[model samples]
Target: MSDSFPLQKLQNITTPFYYYDMELLERTLKTVSEEAQKHGFVVHYAIKSNANPRVLEMIRSFGLGVDCVSGFEVQRALDAGFKASGIVFAGVGKADWEIELGLDNDIACFNVESVPELEIINDLAAQRGKTANVAIRINPNVNAKTHHYITTGLKENKFGINQWDLEKVTDALNKMKNIKLEGIHFHIGSQITDLSSFQDLCVRVNEIHEWFVSQHLAPRVINVGGGLGIDYEDPDQNPIPDFEGYFKVFKEGLNLRGDQEVHFELGRSITGQAGSLITKVLYIKEGVKTKFAIVDGGMTELIRPALYQAYHKIENLSSAAPEEKYDVVGPICESSDSFGKAVSLPRTSRGDLVAVRSAGAYGEVMASQYNLRNIPASAYSDQL
Candidate 1:
C-alpha cells in the first residue's frame, strides 16, 4: 500500500484499504458552507453516503447539521459531535422506537414520507407526550436526470407523500396535533450534475409551497434535498463539487419567504472526492482484446462500478511510462466484479499499486464480505 498517495512517500502497508485526502474534505466542507451561507441555507451532512468516522468529524466541524436515515445514524451523528438540535432524520419506514429516539434526542426534524407514516409518528409522539418536528418529504414527480436506482422524487418512487394526498394528509396532521409541520423536504435524486435540473426543482418547490400556503399550512423550513454531484471522471482536475453554481441556482431562482429557513441534505459532494480505494495489481493477463489488470480489491471493496455501472478513473500510481489499454478487474469470482473494461492506463504489472480515484461516496461504506473475503480497513493521511 501507499501513504498519502500521489504526494507522500509510499509505505509498505496492507493492500486493500480506503485512503482519504483530508485536505480535499476540508476544502469541500468550507466551500459548501460558504456558498450555502450566502443564501441563508443550512446544509446537513447526509451520513448515508459515507459514514466514515474520520470524514464525519471533519464534516461536523463545519457547523453543519446531520441528515440521518436510521436510529443508529442519528446516534452516530450525535456521537460524532453533531449537535442534537441540528440533526434531521428521514426514512421511508421509521420504527416506533426510532421515532422515540428522535423525540428523546430532540432532533431538528423528520422527513415524513407518507400519510400513514405521519399518523404513526403522531401516535408515537402522543404516547411520549412530545411534539415531533417534521418535514413532509414531498414527491414532486420531477425527473432527476440521474440513474434509475438513485432517482427518488418521481411519482412511481416509493418516497414522499403524493400530490393527491396533500389535502387529506394536512387535514390528518391538523387533527393529530402531536406532529409539527415545520418544513417541506424535496430530494429529487443523487449524482445529478446538470444545473438546469436543480432549476426545475426550485420551480417545482415554489409551486408546492404555494399550494401549501393556499391550504393555510405553510411550513417554516424548506429543505430542497441535496443531490449535487462531483466530477468523477477527472478527479484531480475538479476535486471539489460545484458549490458556487449549485447554490446560485437556488438563490437566483427559488422564492423564499422572510422567515423561512432553507435546508440541504448533502452526502457525496462533501466526502466523495476525498477518498480512494487502494489496491495492488496481483497479475496482468493478456486477453483477446484488452489486457486484464487483476487487483486484490474487488467489488467487495467498492460496488459503484458493479451496481450503478459507474465509472471511476483508475490510476497506475507506480507507472510513469507511456499509456496502454487494459481491463481493470478484481479477483472476485462474480462476472460483475470488474472496475472498468477497456480502461486505458500506463503499462501495469504485478506488485503495482492501483489507486481507484473518486470513490469517496458509495464506496467503502457499501463494501461487503462476499466470498468470505476480509472487510477492508481504512487509513487516513494525518494518521499515517
Candidate 2:
C-alpha cells in the first residue's frame, strides 16, 4: 500500500469516493497566497472547479477571493463565508436572476462578455437602482495551446467579445448610467501547461490595454484569468504546482499601470493534486489481450476521462506484487466509461483498492446521476 493513503482505514469506508488531502490543500493554498501577495496580485479560487464546503472553507481561511461563473456559485461562496466584495462573476451566459443576484450582493465585478450582456446588466442594475461594477471580458485572440474544447481566448470561441466589437462596447458603456466599467478580463483557456501561452496573453493584454487607454477608458483591474496546470503524470513528485514561476510570468510580462490590480481566476491548479478517487476493484475479467480491472466508479463520479480523454494516474493501492498491465474501467453501462487503457498496476485481483490520482478540481464538481448511480461521498485526510 502507498504510504500517502491510509489503506487500512480507507477499506472500512465506502468504495468509489473522493479523498482529499487537506494538509496538501492547505499547503497549496499557502504557497498560492504567499506568491500572489509578493506581487500584489489578487488570486480568486475558481469555484466551478470544486465547490465542496470543506474545500471552500479552507480556501476562504487562506484569504483568497472567488471567481464564480454563475449566481449559484456566488451564493455558494457567500454561504461559505466569502465576502461579497471579493467575488467576481464571469460567464458568457448570465441569466437575469444571476445578474440580479450579483447586483443584489454588490459583487466586486461582472466580467461582461458581450455588448448584449453589458446592456442586460445595465438594464437590471437600473431597475435595482444600483450601479453595477463590470469588467469587459475581451477575447485576446491568443491560443492557450490546450484542448480545443477549453481554449476560449481565440476569436472563433464564443467566450469573450472580439477586439473589433470593443468600440461598440465602449460606446454602449458610455451611454449606460447604471454600469460602471471597473476593469478588463481575459481567460485564454483551462489546463494550459505551456507557459509561453501566458506570455502570448500578456502581449495581447498590453495591446488591448493601450487601445482602451487611447479611447480614454483605462481599466483599473486587469483580470488575466488563470489556467496553470498540475503535474498529473507524477503527482507525488510535484504535488504543488510551480506557482512561483507561474506568477512571475504575469508579474514580468503584464504592462500594468501603478493603480491597476492584477487578478487570476485559477481553478484546476489549486485543487487538482490535492484529491483522488478511491475505488475497489469489483471484477478482474480477462480480455483477449489484457485483463480488465473493473471498478465501481464511473463517469458519474469523474467524467474527465470519458469527456475530454483526459489523463489521470491510476494506482493499485492494495497490492505490492509484480506489476502488470490492465485496462482500468468503470461500472457505467456506456462503453466509453473507462478510466485508463492499458494502465500499469500491481498484480490486482477483486477487492483491491484502486486510486485515480489528481482529481481534486473538476472531479466531484462535474459528477452526474448518469446510469442512476449515487453521487460519491468525499473523505478528508485530516478527518481520517
Candidate 2 has an lDDT of: 0.93
User: What lDDT tens digits, residue by residue, belong to model 1 across residues 1-384?
Assistant: 223485343336687888889988888898899999887888998999999888888887889899999999998888888899999999999998898899988898989998888888888888889999999999888898999999999989898888888888888888988888999999999999998989999999999999999889889999999998999888888888889999899888788877998899999998998999989999999988779999999999999999999999898888877888999999899999999998878888898888998889988888899999888888887777
Per-residue lDDT, model 1, residue 30, is 87
Instruction: Report every candidate's CA lDDT.
Output: 0.88, 0.93
Error of 2 at 185 (Å): 0.3
Residues 17-50, candidate 2, lDDT per residue (tens digit)?
9999999999999999999999999999999999
Q: Compare the candidates by lDDT and give the number of the best one.
A: 2
